[model samples]
Target chain A: MVYLHDGSFEGILSGIYKMFHAKAKIDEGKLYEASVYQQSFFELTLNVETERENAHRVASSIYESFGHEGFKYVYYAYLAEDDSYGTLLFRSLKQAYKIGHQAFDALGVEDIRLLTQMANKVSRESHLLLGLLRFVKLENGIYYAPFEPTQNVISILAQHFEERLADQVWVIHDTKRGIGAFYDKTQYHLAPLNSFESLQYARDEVAFQSLWKDYVKHIAIEARRNLPLQRQHMPKKYWQFLTEMK
Target chain B: MEIYEKLRILADAAKYDVSCSSSGHQRGNANKQLGSTAAAGICHSWSEDGRCISLLKILYTNQCIYNCAYCVNRSSNDVKRAAFTPEEVVSLTINFYRRNYIEGLFLSSGIIKSPNHTMEQLIEVVKKLRTREGFNGYIHLKGIPGADESLINEAGLYVDRMSYNLELPTTKGLRLLAPDKERKQIIMPMQQVRDQMIAHRDMKKHLKSTPSFIPAGQSTQMIVGATDETDYHIIKIAEAMYRRLALKRVYYSAFVPGSTHPAVVERGRPPLNREHRIYQADWLLRFYGFKADEILTPDQPQLDLLLDPKCQWALNHMAYFPMEVNRVSYGALLRIPGIGVTSARRIVNARRFSALAYDDLKGIGVVLKRAKYFITCNGKYCGDGDVEPVYLRQKLLEPPKPEQLTLYQTHPEVFDESEATIRGLLT
Candidate 1:
């Protein structure tokens, strides 16, 4: 039997909860929103609606039974937008339920390896974005930064910026996702911000940006120009929002 | 001059220092502060030259009294000079930091009036940033040679890291290039910083709220390819400083000829390849647990440009190779070519469940092309027949084709065979 989810973490967890209760031989499953679902057919297709209570129970069970590391791998793997990741996590969680924490120790298993790989990619992209995200001061004294990360990493990256820039009001908008993590001086919340027209940068923002561009240009030693190495560290995909790159 | 012009002049003068790391300091933000430092530093941007820009690296003033022959800001040189006031420095640091352009400020200076006066001016900017501005970001202050010990101690309280550049590795080289500077003057302040850090750590063990002192520890820079000092001499000094002074890092800057001094001008531009080799050897010393003498012997005073220090060491000690991957310890795994600290740890972790084959080693992060010659999986060798040292050296040192280079340049994500083979050997 195959189950489908609405491409959300809760939806995926609800599918896992149903799969656990049914105890039927599962063939394959995926996010219904993915384009691949339209080309293929399955015998039984149940649309798993997101259930908050069932999702919470499965999340807590994963943590309680397999430990935090296993839960982290599943969570980060779900955040990875790979189409195969949903099925990979479902199978991995089933194995986790049976073997407990030792499921991750079975490196020979294909599902376990793919789950770890997807999670690693998500974690790597999030960490890189933490360093590459640039902010500009707005006229209202709030710092506004925009990033289009490859993964759904805004939720993770927001916590880092909150601790580092605690005194300032800021917004980290994921342009691709159309969602922004807004941080007032005290707390942070996520909201959709489709339009960027509301941002009014400070008058001296241009001057400060020029100063930074000048500093970056002068700081680089002219004799040792390596474009390949530069691109290796700061990939071309992240050049859009970088003030120095502009 | 305008502030932007001053920034260009001062940053250009300060570019040769090459210490841009903002790590090791874990400064949490106070209630009203605007910034904080992570335990592991963040690189805000990388320049075209592939250097990390973690700090607002600039000099407070470029007007100097000392006539250092190799320095761009030497008093005799006919170049533009500029100085920033304490207020201007503080403003630029906080503003640049807020815009996410830099992690913090790395403030160095040329001797404007005296060592004490210049040190005091640097301290004032940091003091104002911490106390009045409530900025809790990383700050790396340069210690002036011959400055009073009390002044150095005072500056240590405000900054995260401090350094006194030992521009020349040997004392004789110091006298030739920078006649006014002495080796003792530089080493004295480093010793003071080290001792104070030890005392602070001891105090923190007993008291819950002992304020941090130089929480990031001290680092120093040495100009490579300037003097006639061999790699042997330089690495010896670095190793000794790491052991004796408890220095966090020892940066190496290749000497760029900026002055018309006969000694510097005669030896054109410094070879960057030599500097790169030293950095690789330095990594082996710090992280790979290799010693100075082990990297270079008395007969061979320099590193091999063809192969990296690690590969060269592995080739020299061929008897240790062809070990089973599933049974080797983590320390022994690190000594293998194409196996770094990360891959070694991964191999140790992944091997607990199932034995790793040559193909499995690739997934575990080990670069198999290079490791094929050095390692085995379940007592099976995957390398080509005839494991001769001369043949392996030639195979590793062969250069890649231009088309392959361009392919790697265009699509860096796609693994080019030649580039990976070379990187596996070099890095």
Candidate 2:
């Protein structure tokens, strides 16, 4: 059997809720996003609509029974963009509910191991982007930064910038997906980007960027130039948004 | 001078002082403040040499009043010198921070006029950034030796971390290389910062509103290989500093040939590997329960460049090897060469449910190739048949060659799980 739902955390949770209520054997079941569903022979596809109450029940059960760490694994795993992330999370959650919070300690379990690895990838990407994301000052005095992270991590990255840059108006745009987190001093909200038009930078933006680039160049000692080490730390994938790299 | 020229010269001069961390402070943003600091520091970029660019590490001025044999900014050295005004420093910090270029400022300076005067100028930059501009970012200041106790104490209230460079490890080295600076001058301010931090913590027990005093604690830098001090001597001093002064970090800088003085010119550039070994031994002192004496003895004064200190220590103490992985405590697990703090915890927690096999150790984040010689899981060992010290040393000395990438595979990020595991084990 195949279950389909909208590509949201709530949709996945509701699917899990329906799976349990129907008492269906999940050994041969597969989960897929509604937007990318593909039918196969002898597979029964069931569309699961997101129900707020059911999603809340599953989320609260996981939080109350498995503790915060368990919820964190689920949260990060949901952000992973892999095709099999849903099935992986489902299998892990099934084991976690049986063994309680100790399920995370079961690194030997294959399902739990795969779930944590996916979660770790999402978290690692978010942390790296936190440092790699560079903001430019827009002409209207707002800081605008755009990035293309492999994982869907804008929601995680937004909370960090909201706290660190509290007094500034900023927008952290995920260019791959047409969405961004807009912050205006007091509040932050996620909104869809209408267009990918680049903003006009402030007059002194070029000067400050040049100064930063110059500092980066001068700070390195020529006698100890390790391009491989530098590339290892700041990967080429992140160099696109870094001003000094340009 | 233009700000661009000042930045180039000052940054070039400051590149040698390598304390780029902006961690250990957790300051939340205020209503009107422009920034905040996270407890775990954030690196904005990486330089070509692979050092983290966490703060805008720059010198306020490169003009000195004394001649030090090993310093590039010494009075006798012929180098371009520039000084940034208090306003200039403030503007640069705010502008860079606003654009997310750096965490904050790491402001160090050479003595322009006098110790007190230089300390005052450095304080002025931080004070203006905090009060006038309302910027609450991480600031690491260099505490000038021989500066007044009052100035050092006042500066600590505004900054997150401070350091007084112990240019050379021993007093004799200081006397020979930097005659103007004395051991007493450097130790006095470090003692002051340590005492003030203690007093502030005591006061905070009674009063809830006592402001922070060097919230990130103090660190000091020691130039290795310049003075004939052995690794044992350097690690002993660092251990004492950590135990007595409550130091946050003891940075070991390899002596690079910068000064053209006859004394410095005689000593060629020190190998960077020596500096790397000192750092590994320093880590054993800080995080792991290993002591300086345990890492290196009087007879074995130098660290083995080919093998890590922990692995070397394990090879020396072969009697304690082949311990049961499931039975050892967390501390004992850390003494293993390949098991770090994180993996040790993972092992301890994961083993509660079932016995860990040799293959299970890898999933728990242990480096099997290194730990195989030292640990056994469920009475099964996968290491070589002959665990002799000489043979094991020969086997471990062969560093793994870098794997060639294929056309489809891309270079992995530094924080990739495998890289992070290797770094955690080594560091």
Candidate 3:
């Protein structure tokens, strides 16, 4: 059986309704697939538009059993592009209903622990990106940086970068999701940044980078030539966008 | 010229002096400053060497008179030299602070012309930041040895904290390594600073709201493994400093064998693990009420790289183990291998309502693996059956001594799974 639905919260809820009606087992499939969760034994349903009541019923039921913390985990996991997250979310909700608050203790068990750990890890990476991600300030003084992050944490990252580099108008485009956040004057918003190349940056960027590179170079004492030590401190991955590396 | 030039030179020179912790100071807003110093848990940063960069730590000048072999800024090293006038530093500090770049300044210097000359310049920077700039930010200044007592006293009044680095552990180490520096030059200034602080406190008892003078207290740095000095000798010196001088901290920096001086050991840098273990030992001495001789002996001059200082000591004295958790006194609570000050307090607080079982011990954040061998729950031993003293010692120390990773965190990957486990050992 396959349940194909539009990539929306309502559509996913409608699919959940079908699964409940048939009492079908959930299976993993590529999220981007037009037809996903297909199995040979059960009937395949193509559900597109979702009723508002059906989506609300599914969300409220999970919320009733586990309170707010459990709902937040479910919503975040749903938003995560991985299809396996949806199955884990379903299993966690079903188990929580079975055991009540004791199920909340089970939420701290290894499987959910991995999910929280991954979320936390992604959150930390995004925060670091906000600080360390360098923008090539263009001739017109528009600062821009495009990064491909493994986690969909660009939205969280955008807030911190917007606060820190407040004086300038900048753009942090997430290449993985083909979306970007823009901070112009006071307001900030997320919008599609389709054109990856031909992006402009501030003119004095090269000069500033030269000075920064020279600064880091002068500080590194040659007598302590611990490449292993240096690699341990600053990883090769971060060196890609660093001014000194260029 | 530009502030960047001064920062590049001054900060680079200051990196050598490993005493930039914005820690153990408590204060609220007084005059016109923006932030207050915290009592504990101030964040530290990492240099290229991966050391914690807690402050905008910098030298007043790299120019020197005394040539200490263990110091990079010794008189003979043919390195580029620079000096920051007091006003120059004040401007840089204000600018960096405004940019949210640093918590405060950690000012140290080479002995330029004389110790008094260096101390005066260092004093001038703290004074200007305090009175002229109205900067109430956390400032940790290094007191130059052999400087005028009055000069050191005045410097202490303006700075949040001050330190005198005992570069070598022993007097014999001092004579051999740093010929010009005497043991008295370092200890004398610390004594003067302590005397001034005590006198200031005494006057404050009568006067309501007497001004703060070095409210964070004084600290000192000891260069570990620099000479033939053992960990026993190094920790002994630190224990004495903590007890006699009332020092707030005694930082142990592993000798990095890069000093250009002819006298320094060119072969092996001190195992970073040894320095880490010494810090763990130092913590036990301060908070756990453990004595230096109790932690280590001259015969066993080195700390076990595998087990922590407390764990090693507990292994050595297993007859004292299986102390009943419910009835053990607070003094005995401190003696348990895995029980820190926090966990001991937790046990005391939690046991007031209910008797703590083996499970409840975990709730109080005790490591069951280590603590099980030492503590008894409801007067029953939960440790391994083969709990002989020698066997326990071997068990505690046999865990593969994970490689020593430097505490200097410059990048993210320095914390790969294996290295992060090692990093935990060092911090």
Candidate 4:
């Protein structure tokens, strides 16, 4: 059935919950049935509004039957946010309900395989940003890091630095999404950040940046300098924010 | 000297080091410390030379008493010299770490007055970083070759990883290139650190309060192509180090020509290809269960410049060709040229549901371009034409040779500043 949910996580889940019991409850609603599993069709599209209640039921079904591993795949895929990602969540959730945990290992299935790839792409970005994301100390003793990650991975990056850099107050701004994560030494919270104001660097920031640039230059072995390999690890899209690249 | 000059000189002195890994410790921010070590490690940046800038890799000082000819900081050379105070190193590590420019600090030093004194100077920095600053980040300390055992052990308690460079592969290479360092002098501290790590593991089993002893274990590096050591010799040494000493890693650094010392060799270009081939074999030894003798023999003492060790082995043993992927054991699946650890595991897992075909292989992560030469699907051979070794060898292409490009990270005049004319290669 074509059950279109609002693109939110809860809406996606509500859509999946309605799809699973399509034959019974979905027939009376404004929804229209489509082929399930392995290439779904859209004869009709019905927006799902039973969001929170249905979202809770599907989430518990995933946790109870397939364990946390299956939910990780769904959540990361959701974060990846492709154009038809909602339909992907619905199809993979159907896989979880039918085959239970085996759905994860069933890489032969196209939807499951794509979900795995999307989740992996999200994870790879999260891991890369852990190192690539640079923080510039502002004039007021606040460390602010600005980045443009393709995937919505602020949650992952925030949790890592919150524990790793526990004693400092910092802000991680996702400029592309207009959102920011603010951590106040003890805890962190996320809020909308449409645009950023021009901030001055700390007094010693320029001197340290010069020292850092020299270190990066001198540490490279002249015999093995391969810019292609360096670019392969640190791509062109993320160069504007890097202190060394600048 | 200013921190700028000190950093430039010390970092240039330390660039020959190939150990840039910052992993192996899961130490967290205890009592709300300034930093924590990630278990898988993180690379904060990559230099233009295409190597990882994981840590603030630098030397405490570039002033050396012993003249190691292959080293730029050798006493015989008149290069610029500088050193950082213990306070300077602590502050640099904290500031760079806070800016997310580096994961931690990799501190090594030239023998200041003596081996014990240099080791002590290195330890004092880490001691302050850990205790005073409450830094729980990754640390890779250089273990002075002939330092006292007590000092080496105590340094282990403060750092996550320790390494003593086996500067040259064989004793003959040490005599030829770095005459001041003896093979035994380097091995002593490595052995001491290994024994301490073993004792720490056993002690921790009984008492939970036992502090970590180099929880990342010990790793070593050797200069390749500077002297005429065979790939066979280097691989065997690395294999023995892993088996006997329980070392975590062994790095191979291609010698870069940057000194005027008479002992330095390979004046034209670094033998990066030879270094690359040896690393290919090193991975096979560490993960692929291949022995040193299996990779290279006295009959063919060097690795093939064109073929990888695994593909070379596969070509040699054609009897194992055209193996059915679905039926083969996981070990055999790994032996195939295109199937890696991940692809092999995927094939094994996916086959449980149904047999994989050539199309399924690509999705599951097999390099069909290479694997099609050796593997079969569903009792059908998908290899192009006959799987003859000679034809397959011709089909494989090689990477760009090193002679085409120069490693001029800066302009060529960067060398003119030193005026330390390396022999005929770069005149």
Scored by lDDT, model 3 comes in at 0.70
Off by over 4 Å in 4: A23-42, B399-427
Least accurate stretch of 10 residues (summed lDDT) in model 4 chain A? Answer: A28-37
DockQ of 1: 0.56
Runs in model 1 deviating more than 4 A are A24-36, A65-68, A96-108, B30-32, B398-427
- Quote model 3's iRMS: 7.1
Better of 3 and 4 by TM-score: 4
Better of 2 and 4 by TM-score: 2
Question: What is candidate 1's lDDT per residue for A78-117, written digit by digit as tens?
Answer: 7888877767777777665666565675565667878988
Global lDDT of each model? 0.86, 0.88, 0.70, 0.85
**Per-prediction TM-score to the true structure, in the order listed:** 0.93, 0.94, 0.65, 0.92
Instruction: Give the Å error, residue B151, model 1.
Output: 1.5
fnat, candidate 1? 0.67
Per-residue alpha-carbon lDDT of candidate 4 for residues B1-427, written as tens digits (9 for 90 to 100): 7888898999998988899899988987757768888889999899988889999999999888889988888998999989999999999999999999999999999988999999999999999998899898899999888789999988999999999999888998898877778889999888888888989899999999999899999999998878887888899999999999899999998888777677676467888888898999998888787899988888888999888888898988989888999999998998888778889888888888788888988886678877888888998888888578888887654545677456465466767755556545476
Number of clashes recorded per candidate = 0, 0, 11, 2
lDDT comparison, 3 vs 4, better candidate? 4
| Order of candidate numbers by DockQ, starting with the best | 4, 2, 1, 3
Q: Per-candidate DockQ versus the true complex? A: 0.56, 0.58, 0.06, 0.71
Error of 3 at B371 (Å): 1.6
- Give the clashing residue pairs of candidate 2, or none: none
